[model samples]
Target: MAKGQVFVSMALALLVFMHVGGIRGEMRGGGEEGDRILALPGQPKVSFQQFSGYVTVNKVVGRALFYWLTEAVHDPLSKPLVVWLNGGPGCSSVAYGASEEIGPFRINKTASGLYLNKFPWNTEANLLFLETPAGVGFSYTNRSSDLFDTGDRRTAKDSLQFLIQWMDRFPRYKTREVYLTGESYAGHYVPQLAKEIVTYNAISKHPIYLKGFMVGNAVTDNYYDNLGTVTYWWSHAMISDRTYRQLINICDFSRLKESNECESLYSYAMDQEFGNIDQYNIYAPPCNNSDGRTNGCTRHTIRLPHRPHPIFRQMSGYDPCTEKYAEIFYNRPDVQKAMHANTTKIPYKWTACNEVLNRNWNDTDVSILPIYRDLIAAGLRIWVFSGDVDSVVPVTATRYSLAQLKLSTKIPWYPWYVKKQVGGWTEVYEGLTFATVRGAGHEVPLFKPRATLQLFRSFLSGQPLPTKS
Candidate 1:
């Protein structure tokens, strides 16, 4: 009788220990499990959970960066975590990357609803979208001056801090492998942040398990980007021969401020490019905001409640007004509350691209190749992909920039197939991988979602893109 009681007591103790250990692991994210979101206003029902809120990078000044986390549909606990960013120096990642690209939902055409994204990144990995630095989206600083005073180094530092503190909120993710990715201006943001993480991991006891980074249609080097733009335009027959010649002969993109002749040619090129079509994807049609358009001259003029930029339009959808539709959906008061985005209720409304930051961007590295080289030397996976049709940051610019690195080709360029069709071409280099998405524009995933997913899956899995016939 005495021996039986002792055995039963020991079993109960072991069970209690296991239960406590499991709870400790579950204590992750932003809310209860750290920032666990109950649900979005119009979000589809799913077993996977989500959370959104701010990570106070600067506790004293209350400089907090907002973030949205969407768990994987299948195995949230076991999958890797991808921290995604969208570039604009001051763009809203939630607005563009999440809503438009790889995120779980897209704003419905009605601009008053949400629709499921069939190929959301959350299907595979846990997705976290951040509004970095400050004064972009709902992120803000108590010292409002920080809005105008953000730069590359400062932004990177704040981002590193946000990740660390964010992990504190979602402790379970502390040990998971992390992939940092972004597009457009994030060419700068991702590399710089990855450097910070690698540097910190060297000294810190609890380090970020950063595996790699990828940027798409990114602004890597200004000179190469500009030169490549003109080259691409001419090569693709998008610009007149005279304009192309003038740009090449007279313009010096390497110069800090372009010469009057260069500026004139550049302006002419842009004017021709932007007039009838979107500058992002050259082949895409212009957003005709007239009666024949989708909304048909509704009272909402794309910015009645929201202040739309005259020069910088909100036309991301297939019709160019999809971006405007996204703006409406995001700006809804109920959406804000559900996502826990604007806890501080900042004054300025959310815009996809923040014009203030773009104009007043205090610092920009001429070339991020040095950083890329360093990361590659550290044995980090480095991939740079481009949308072949993106005039803004065309594949030509990426090719030009990578050529400067002169990495020996490990795998000669070849077409990577998806669904038994050639999706795009890729080259695996000694320290870098270069890829191009065919028939895609500036935002590759938005233009070619399924191909983008195949590309991304191959990247994360450390596999070459399939060449099978």
Candidate 2:
């Protein structure tokens, strides 16, 4: 299927009522055997288990019931818990979190190789990646008539219910420090979920010790985010002054929606001067493959050779695809099963960038800014990271969205040296911090694995940003 049509189908599927009750029928019971969920057979060597059963959220009738992923390594008594959600309102946490970001494994482009990621985010603390608000990923409902028309309110309520059920399943970790993390559109998911957690704590008196949150190159505001992209292009010297002015003048920031038109506007700005800027072209169609016949291969092939060539260029300056992590993730059957993904169904060539866009999620609300403020005020550490080269949710957009907070700069911005003058820069203020990864686009981990690993380590430990000096 064409990528555009596939996205349209996914959007339509969300509109239809597909009963997902049967998928959770076997989720009864408790303990290791019950919790040690195994991935379906035929996946790579990674193995993970689901700890908590389903939670029914009666607060909202049409939108209820959600599930959470438990770390493969268990410590039921006294381990911190982290919950992760991918954006899209329909994208699977397993698809992005497990496969692309912090999960233990990453799939090879051809879906033939599985490699282990040395810095799987879960290594520091227990992690839980969830598909919330139902109809997303594997979390389903028996009510084929259930409403999948989800928003921040429904998602927050459903996620709260899921956490309540999760705690009940493993009571020992009830007091464990809980953190929420996500990327892309999850700029909406994290704050809303945190607010729900705080509200539930106030009323129930039994709260999931919500610690902090981390989001990467997220989408929070429409006007600033769109406008920032134009400035970012100019700052990076990818666009000319005339083209930037054209974008600022012609683009409708108010009716801002993701579509082919958005792609065209950005394309015009980038093509004004072609100096090999992949960031601008990240969302635009390739100049060579306008027919879409060669299938978005033009976009993916720009970084390295396709097909007979190595899928990943080794950062160690050796053969591409030589990293131990990539090899293990692609090859691990357990990780695949835990992800609950069907690699066979997806195209053999899968890059984080090549995934189908969610056309159905054109309208998103940004009212959750207050919730983020509340979390920061409550003394939770917040970290927002961005891949400077990612045009989808670029670093420029992040800065503009954060400017809405009106936060007092407690700590001034400074370079976060990764290796000599490499890595990137970081800024700390009050309880929140923002950082960017050098040479990395949207998928920071995929592009700069070692640097990303270091960033996570510093984030989890609450340690001061590392310096290469």
Candidate 3:
């Protein structure tokens, strides 16, 4: 009734309006409040911040990419952002990258609890794991056909779009120094995405500050890769010398089609010569369970090489059945809800790699060496690492591919040390660096967590892998 009372009420109303207006503004810019994860089921207490959610790359088709961000253990705001992708071409980065390798947590054997990865990469950088393309992991598209037609070009474009929109959501990272890293098919995805980012920065008003990229046991040049692989089989005594010769002579990787002899020899090498060992990590015990299905949603009596297909399971080393655990863990309703995944209640269960997308993948660059050259010339820091014991994409294959680069060596080959022991070897070229984890398998981190952590620390700091004990 009084003039003073009326004035006070209007002031309070204005303050409330301002507060709501600010919150709305944050949401429009892709505020991360909604995405911030409180905790995960059975997860151990952690000091760092975590966030996960979907970033829609294609609104028209309703295609969304899923990402999980694990902030640095300390001073997260000061750490650079590193995006980790796992290459299935159809695999879920969440399953491989986040749940096992480099991520903050590791799923237990029973899929009932989580344990901290002693060497989590987030210690040095804000690690972001992304399940790329529409069909992988929790990432999905409303348009059913999108799954069938996914390929390199579209995946890169969508990823760039995701980053752009993701930056809008987590604006602090918009201009932060960023790096791309992955393994297996991600060998293709990482470089392709880097090229996309470099190209995009040229024209976009908001540019992603891509500093460098690193891939482990990556699928690089096909010819060299095939050549190196056969050589590795022979050198490691996995295949007979006779089979090795046949592979070298008969398998023409450059050809678009395979000859019958090549097919037979390859099959013979795998079926008979290679034995029942884990191809991803030759020395490690293979998951002898014959019932592991390709979909990996359920267990049955089946002989499995364990892990995933050669193209996607880059990081299987010690645990032969780690992927099965990932399957059991991720498929939990509580886990899905905590991560804000599978909100649509998709008809199919979450699998590590989508066979349909991998099979139907339309286009693949025969060789990523050209893109490597471009990125190298553009002065981006590039590091290619391989695990020596990986039969699928062995160290020898990576060595052969880098030799083709023909860059003069900066730091000659030398053993890099970790904990007073030889961890691996490294050589720096003018534009790129190549390293090998001496006794590791397909995925270096999974086999040699400490060694890989040193490698990553050196990479982020632009330092050489330690030459001293």
Candidate number of the best lDDT: 3
lDDT by residue (372-463, candidate 2, tens digit) is: 68888888889989888776567887888788888888667777776665678888877788888887766566566678878877887887
In the predicted model 3, the residue pairs found to clash are: 30-169, 87-186, 290-302, 290-303, 291-300, 291-301, 291-302
Angstrom error of the Cα, residue 54, model 3: value is: 0.7
- Candidate 3, superposed: residue stretches over 4 Å from native: 1-30, 290-319, 344-347
Write model 1 residue lDDT over 231-301, tens digit each, in one string: 88889887888888888889877755677777766666665543455556667654445564422211121
| Every candidate's lDDT | 0.75, 0.59, 0.78
Better of 1 and 2 by TM-score: 1
In the order shown, what is each candidate's alpha-carbon RMSD? 13.9, 6.5, 12.2
Estimate the TM-score of every prediction.
Answer: 0.86, 0.75, 0.88
Q: In candidate 2, residue 245 scores what lDDT?
A: 83
TM-score of 3: 0.88
Q: Tens digits of per-residue lDDT for model 3 on 1-469?
A: 7855553343333223322322332243336988888999999999999998778787786677778999999998899999999886688888888877899998887999898888899989999998888777777666666766778888889999989998888999887999999998788899999999999989988889999999999888878887887788899998898888777877897754567878777777776777666677677654434465332211110111113453223334445557788889887867876777654333335678766676567878888999999999889999999888877778888888889989998989999999999999999999998998978877678889999999999999998899886
Q: Cα miss at 237, model 2 (Å)? A: 3.3
